[model samples]
Target: MTTLLTPDELEAALRTIGAERYHNLHPFHKALHGGRLTRGQIQAWALNRYYYQASIPAKDATLLARLPTPELRREWRRRLIDHDGTEPGTGGVARWLKLTEGLGLDTAYVQSLDGLLPGTRFAVDAYVHFVRDKSVLEAIASSLTELFSPTIISERVSGMLRNYSFITEETLAYFAPRLTQAPQDSAFALAYVKEHARTVEQQQAVINALKFKCGVLWSMLDELDYAYVAPGHIPPGSFRPQDDR
Candidate 1:
């Protein structure tokens, strides 16, 4: 039988997963932050990523439905507001649209998701389904990826500002609030997992959940890299770069 990990040990193990498998290590991110991608390629990324951004609230709502406590429900409800806002034309989704618009993507076309890659769609939808169908422990554990977000957001904001003239601070505003929000969310999630995952199996499941979430993120970038970068094989009907568009 697997031994149960101490809470500190489990936390360390989770951080180790982030160190090794997070999408920050993906070549697509390296290309993006390094400014190696052309404007059209960046546009393709923004357009496709908008689908993931738009789906976040729905994912949280599904998880929210599964929470057992009014306190937990109230805590999780903040995520809905963070993404969807109390009103339309605000919140993270709206900020993401600003990014897409700044990238010269038509907002209608972006929202239509008409140009989104099949892989991006599949990966993101899988996340929503995972949260809906999995154990609440696993679902919350999956969000532990947020533990690493602040660092990546800082890198991305600074790199994009320095490297891409087309990228203004306003275009990158979506990440600014996330710098604070992600840490708060992740801390709660990490504490919840460490507190609740009392058995060996549950601890292992939590670790696997983080791995699965990382795979979801990494695979999105893999598709982007395969389709958008070298030997480019963008699938039919997806957004084509400007040269091809």
Candidate 2:
């Protein structure tokens, strides 16, 4: 039987998962931050990533409904508010549209998700389903990816601003609030996982949940890289960087 890990040990294990498998290590991100992609490639990225951003609240809502306590529900609901906002034309999703618009993508087109890559849709949907169906412990642990996000967000904001003149601070405003929000969210998730995952089976499940979440993120980039970078096999009907109309 697997041994149970101490809370500190489990936290360390989760961090190690982020270090090794997170999308920050993806070549697409390296190319993005290195300013190696064309404006159209960046446009495709913003357009595709918008789907992930837009789905966050729905995913959180699924988990929110499953929380057994008022405190847990209250804490989880903060994510919905952060992403969906107090009203429309605000919050993280709105800020993401601002990015797409700044990238010259039509807001309606991006929101319509008309040309989103098949892989992007599948990967993101899997996340929503995971939260909805997994044990609440696994569901919360999946969000532990946010623990590593602040660093990547900082890297992306600085790198994009410095390398891509077309990208302004306003264009990347989506990440600014996330700098604070992600840490707060991840801290809560990590603590919850550490507190609740007391047995060997539960601890391993928590670790696997983090790994699964990382795969979701990494696969999204894998599709982007395949379609836009090497081999350049963009699936039919998907947004084409060359067609930037």
Per-model TM against the reference? 0.98, 0.97
Off by over 4 Å in 2: 243-245
Worst 10 residues of 2 by lDDT: 236-245
Clash count per candidate: 0, 0
How well does candidate 2 match the true structure in TM-score terms? 0.97
Q: RMSD per prediction, one decimal?
A: 1.3, 1.4
Off by over 4 Å in 1: 243-245
The sequence of per-residue lDDT tens digits that candidate 2 reaches over residues 25-64 is 9999999998888888899889999999999999999999
